[model samples]
Target: SIDRKVGSQLMPDTSPGVSRSSQLDSETHPHVDDTPSSNEHHRPTPLPAQLQGRATNKTFQSMTYVPGLTPKIAGILQSKVPEGTVITSTMSRSPPPPNERSSVVYRLGCKGCEAKYIGATVQKTEKRFSKHRSDVRNGILATALSRHTLSSTGNHEFDFEDFDIIGTEKVRKKLMLLEAALIKQERNRINIQEEFAAIDNCYNNLLLNLNNH
Candidate 1:
């Protein structure tokens, strides 16, 4: 028994056992973790050098369109305005079909003459202007303005700068009343000679009735 004990201490155990050095190595140098660190994930992306000081928040503003100066104006605006500011054009363009939910009252005037035309539209004022132009071009003579343009001016030409939007209203009756009020206020300026009295009388009666109600 004494000899067996001495031999057992001298010979290392080899029955499916790991070496001491390998076990110590595994504890010291563990497998690398493939997951990324939290700091790396939270890092922000860098902006371009030119855009470093510019703001990212946006603001929009309306501007009138000038035929030849619009492009130059836009370029100047882009350079002067902050990086995120947006500019919008207020000039009327071809709008879609009529929408009765919103109504607009507007006026159109001759650039050199005092002749003005008061009008209302259920759709956008742009669409209404397009219709007026179409009627004038076709010689429809449907409105007093069309008649005046055909009789006075040999050609159908008007100044775009003279166009103005008076007001907007959702209610049809209120819109009509507003239109009548504008027409009455600008009565002397309009060019409808024979039809003026009739239109004025009609609007006056409507106003009187509405007031009574």
Candidate 2:
């Protein structure tokens, strides 16, 4: 009882789960369909090379034709952004040399006259100008600018350069109150009238208008 047709559909030759030598091997296999015939298509998916390959019937609704999905999203944003990474906004910095500063408030003229000397130091104004040239080389007037540089006689002097910060304060009582407001805004100051008479001229006109700017 074996026969096969399939044109009007009816191929049995051995039903109950076929096996009569595999239904006589279906006369050497013929009717094989897993659903596709109706003109069987599906071979279109090409247009890609940066869309410069022009051919737009607009299909997949636009992912620029998906392959490598936008270069795998730009290679995952260039491996999470970091190639010579530089983004500054307003980069500029430079100012730190005056003898490595430090809570100072200095000034010390007198290369022979107009004698000024306001001072202060938490150290490192070149180590407080080397302790005022070691208290005028060991005559130790112990300050008041070493007793006006060892007793002011016309044309006084004092050396060892680099002085004149005039202000800075990491607070040592606001750096000697900015060295008593710059020795109460000097005027040929040699700093020692009880150190500008212990400050109190009702802010001597705001310290002489901050020493005229």
Candidate 3:
């Protein structure tokens, strides 16, 4: 009977005892969603398609600072590599102990000759000096000072007492820059033999390349 009555009027039942008032309320004002609308301002904006692809495809690289060669090497890598293909970053050498941190630049004067070798190190001055002496005795031709000592003198032993701390810096870059400056200044004075000129030339080339950058 109720379905027939509502069908005749083509409207929902509003009779007493049939939840009529609630039905009428629902019809007049539909249920409002209690869940809040998403705030566009707080939502994270996605990266652009190109950038997204680049980020996925890009290769990350970490290069250690090589005293004089780092800047030029970094520049070369940036210039030669595709813009989004490779990401290059420079990392400094590992930090030394607190005692060694205060000793940055050092100079080693030859006992026989006036020639001096300027160097920078993050390690303690005494430790570095010991290593240099060891390297010289071991005939390590890789270092200019060691090569000079072996080639220029009859004896391979370096004077441990001849070395002195020239300056100190907290930053390795400042110490390296100071070392480079000192090397440049003392380049002409150092008696690097003709055979060991290549070692010095390679170092000088690095300095030149660094300056060019």
Candidate 4:
């Protein structure tokens, strides 16, 4: 009887379809992965922490969008605060000065007598008052107030501190009419002859009757 003993199982048999040498080659060197390598150049860098959001300049009208910024690049550039834009903001102007107001009815009081003068001006009140001051001082102008001041008055100045505003009107004739009516309202006044003639004697009689009551 021959004992057919196998010598240490003679290197296990390979599949019928594949050879043993090919299986050994596959186990030693595996398949290559197609993923990127860490050493790969030309890779996109991430944005810096300050510039991470979309607005590097967005949504804010005050900001300017800056591209190509990165933490590493900023550090190399020695970053500092950028200068701000200069805006020429302006405010609306205010109204003219009080004494510079126009279309006004004003009164002037005499320093020596109970004489009052009611007048109106299309120009500024200060301009009219300045002319009146110049008139009494120089005696050049022949305006009604100046005539009275030059001829009848003992005072030098027109008592500008006593200058007062009585009313305001824009229409020329109507403003003069207001001055006329105001002159009538006052008991004592220095007015031009024409203004005095325009008043109704009946109105004076009515005022006299009312005051008597």
Top TM-score: which candidate number? 4
Task: List the candidates ranked by lDDT, beginning with the highest.
Answer: 2, 4, 1, 3
Which pairs clash (backbone N, Cα, C closer than 3 Å) in model 3? Answer: none
Instruction: List the RMSD of every prediction in angstroms.
Output: 13.6, 22.6, 9.2, 24.4
Model 2: per-residue lDDT, tens digit, 1-213? 234444435544545776766555556675754467766576667667876665445322212111222344445555785452322122157647767777777777878876778777788778878878888879898778888877877646764474667566675865665577667767777777665454567867856764665
Q: Cα lDDT of all candidates, in order? A: 0.62, 0.63, 0.61, 0.63
On residues 149-209, what C-alpha lDDT tens digit does candidate 4 reach at each position? 7887366346766677776666776677666656665676777667645556765664444
Q: Worst lDDT window (10 residues) for model 4?
A: 62-71
Residue-wise lDDT of candidate 3 within 1-213, one digit each (tens)? 999977889775667677876666767879754457778459888898777855555456654333445555666776887573433353368765433545466667777766777767787777777787788768787677787787874553456665555555567655655565445545434523442332344567656555565
Superposition error at 196 for model 2 (Å): 14
Better of 2 and 3 by TM-score: 3
User: Model 1 over residues 76-112: C-alpha lDDT tens digits?
Assistant: 6778864545454553875433332238766778654
Candidate 4 deviation (Cα RMSD): 24.4
Please give me the total number of clashing residue pairs in predicted model 2.
0
Candidate 4, lDDT over the whole model: 0.63
Residue 3 local lDDT, model 3: 90
Q: In model 1, state the lDDT of residue 184.
A: 56
